[model samples]
Target: MDKKKFPVLIKYCFLKGKNTVKAKTWLDAEFPDTARGKSTIKHSYTKLRCGEMNTEGGEHSGRPKEVVTDENIKKIHKMIATECVHHIIDEYLGMRKLCAKWVPHKLTFDQQ
Candidate 1:
């Protein structure tokens, strides 16, 4: 249910002297098969009863920021260049099979 409607529903229930359970029952009956469940109704009731319910939602802690700036780009580019050149030299010069034991497992899998 929309957060905007919570205040109105809570107000109506308040005026009618209905308990949270009664309000929840009415909401479930009215908005059947909805995303809103018992927990949502109960939470709204708790907020309304505690005088914390507001029109605007509170700020939430979301995913952490992962900014890939110019420094990160240059570092990644250098790593890729080094790895590719090493692999190319080993494979083209026929040194890969002889030195296969020395090569890292990750590099072998990547080459394949």
Candidate 2:
């Protein structure tokens, strides 16, 4: 049921000369709940045919995983505290709304 096993099984089927559909059927029979999709089996078969023998996935430029270490968490907390303090100071000093004007929520045509 492990994901890594799927590619290995698919590769075995390919090497055994089983076509994509047959490989999918075999996998379904073996792993009813966690069988890989037909397209996935076919893709793996194609890759095997193209000389990509590695059953594992290749390196891809995906979004980097967020590491939630204590150090990272502390850094994030420090940044958030600094930002909050800055916001509070700016608001108290009236520095954030210097070019603002008050208006009614529902404006009349003349006001607009």
**Which structure among the candidates has the greatest TM-score?**
2
| TM-score of candidate 1 versus the correct structure, residues matched by position | 0.43
Superposition-based RMSD of candidate 2 using all C-alpha atoms, in angstroms: 8.3
Q: In candidate 2, residue 68 scores what lDDT? A: 73
> Cα RMSD (Å) between model 1 and the true structure?
9.4
lDDT of 2 by residue, 1-112 (tens): 7897888888889989999999989889989999999888878877888999997777879766878789999999988876785566565543343337533445579967
- What shift in Å separates residue 63 of candidate 1 from its native position after superposition? 2.2
Q: After superposition, which runs of candidate 1 have C-alpha atoms over 4 Å from their true positions? A: 1-11, 64-112
- What lDDT does the true structure give each of the candidates? 0.65, 0.80
Structural similarity to truth (TM-score) of each candidate: 0.43, 0.56
Q: Which candidate number has the best lDDT?
A: 2
Worst 10 residues of 1 by lDDT: 97-106
How does candidate 2 fare on TM-score? Answer: 0.56
For candidate 2, list the clashing residue pairs, or say none.
none
